[model samples]
Target: MASFPPNRATTLKAAFRACDVGPLVGADIERYYVDLSNVRNTEAIESLNTRLDFLEPAEFCSILFTGHRGCGKSTELRKIQKRWEVEYKVIYIEADAEIDILDAEYTDLYLVIIKKVADELNKLNLKFDAQLLHNFETWFKEITQETEQTVERSVSISASAEAGGQIPFISKLLGKIQAQIKGADKQKQTIRQLLQKDIGRLQADINLLLGDAFVKLKQKYPEYEKGFLIIFDNLDRVPPNVANHLFFDYSEQLQSLHCTIVLTAPISVVYSEKNLSNAFDTPNIVPMVNIYKLERQRGDLEYNDVGIKAVASLIEQRVDIDAVFESPQDLLELVKASGGHVRQLMRITAKAFLTAATRKHNKVTTDDVTYAIKQEQFNFERSIPTELYSELAKVCLTKDVPKDENGWLMLFSLWVFEYNGKTRWNYINPTVRQSDAFQEALQSITANP
Candidate 1:
């Protein structure tokens, strides 16, 4: 909850800052989190919590957590991490931060995981069996043709404190390999090819290290009864080809790692023609909060009060909405138009706040809100293909997203949003549907029918 400031300008500035679209982390999570599980009609947090809380540490389960880019998936993942970290050593890796996302391979992630595990265990003063480390080190060196001398020579010029002379051999080797993969250099493909040849050996070596680490952790901290939980975030940000490569071509590789892992994938993966469940369980989708009703009557879609309140709560938790907006109803108007996409709401709110401040309005007016949404709608419009308009019309009319590439495209582009009622469904984005072209397409389809 937020307290009112005496000056309207102070409130406006606070509103603008509160509307940042980035994921909330650390203390900010306490201040700004809104539980939308009931509104979205999916138990996203509980599903992961139940699995991790109940499963035996040796079970080695993997769950696919998915949603649109800004529907608060990362925030939810952080929540999951917070809940499970007490029992599991959570290694939260941002794929884009650690890998060349577009060009990443499964082996790239393998190296990243190994690097992180070895580094963490080193920090904890836990040592792997010397022979075990020596065997893997010798094999790794033979394949990549790197030894202590060469690694020391290469990284000496620009040495980081973490990968400095004092660290173990595995950490130094992994540091060099991770930099190569992320750097997109000639050696990237060479290393990947070497590891790809013996995928099982790579997985086996890593799992052994993980097992050793798990044993040490259990012995050291009784709280760590359960083993490691790797929260692999931002894998969803990879391009479709990379996603296909990581999740499809090497689905088994992603699953074979020995840990209770939570991985994020693009929404497209849920609708992909491939039966992903055979490889991993059905993806746990973080559907949009139910803004519009499941069915429209008399060609009018009704807003769900529960959904509106949840979306508004997301903003109110950060900003004193009544103080910033001209009226509570005006804030409602912004929420309805936001379509329950958290980032989109923030974007609209921030712009409207800036617009009102520029005009010196005491509060954000409906005109400012409208201007912000229209600007967002136009940006979305530019990305959409002309031919997709009719298809979007069909989705709007049917209240169902087609199970195909077009459906995936519409979702990926944010031209449509998924929801859950008695069953899963989709609807056009409110701003997109408000566009003249969409309205005309809707009319044309109705007239033809």
Candidate 2:
């Protein structure tokens, strides 16, 4: 709905080339970033930055960063890494990239964190003190009955004899154990149980390593004024059971680490029975970019012109909407249907582009948009049970999500979207309301009422 820059793509091929359904990373951040902090009403990463960088006594605490899966949480975290690289030796741990997320346990995370910190520092030629390394390695050996020889048998690290130091042996040992955890091998559970037997010792050892690493880094690297910052991304992909085990059951253990840690969580965690306030500070939530205007009456939400324009800018930054769509209104239609979800908008736009090409259209038409949205609506309809349709209609009417399991499931599934105003509220996904099941359900409820 808003005019875009002139240097955008002109051909359908160019439009297709511009589509990226994943989060922006690397150089793309500088190219395609749209600042929706004003619209989402939360400066998710900046708040953490303020706490760590600006606060008087240097607040070092475990942070909970959460949002819907594709609402640009990773992109924001990358922004933090890039923004504070000089001040913090940031170690970003991507759970999916590094671990078996579905079955991950707290012990597995402990292994992953220590291994990564060691590996990262080793790359900088900054090793933990040799005595500390020997102490930790000897403890691991006795606890798990795992010696350096047995560890090398599982993972193919070179002979430790050539690496003449305790740090290399310690690094190799951690690598082997973490590999066992990541590979889900026979030793995985054993390692977990052994670690859990003395989990406090494990925590103590890690904090010792962190403390030494902090001192070593601060001493060697004067530019690193804030020490180490470890961010755990995509931890949200873990199932609810595992999330509860990590965040609720073992929260204090997680917080006990003497470093600034940010853990991404599923958006549903906020509504869980266990209050996050009991464990960590208030979670820094990156809410959906509100496509609707502020101060609207309940159940009568209208699109905000500025919000719509911002959503369009997200697309325009990637593809030339003028080149892709037959009319500006066609782009607007997709934007409204996106419910301000970044990945959803890209999905719809890409699908419409492909559908247009198949239909022999030079540019994306309203017909293509309708087909894409209907396809998405069909997906949401199938995933939702018939019984929930009435409940979804009620959420649409009241702009509130129930704080029980059902509501958490709905938000997790994207059947409902959370938006920020004076307070947060829920509404049905824009395309979901287009389905016949939902329409019928809403009409039935209205008529009966």
Cα lDDT tens digits for candidate 2, 50-136: 776763223478889998888889888998889889788899998998788878887777777888788778768798988887788
All candidates' TM-scores? Answer: 0.92, 0.91
Model 2 backbone overlap count? 0
* Model 1 lDDT tens row, 143-178: 888978988766654455644555778978987888
- Report the lDDT of model 2 for residue 335: 93
Clashing pairs in 2: none
RMSD of each: 3.1, 3.9
lDDT of 2 at 32: 75
lDDT per prediction? 0.81, 0.81
In model 1, pairs of residues that clash are: none
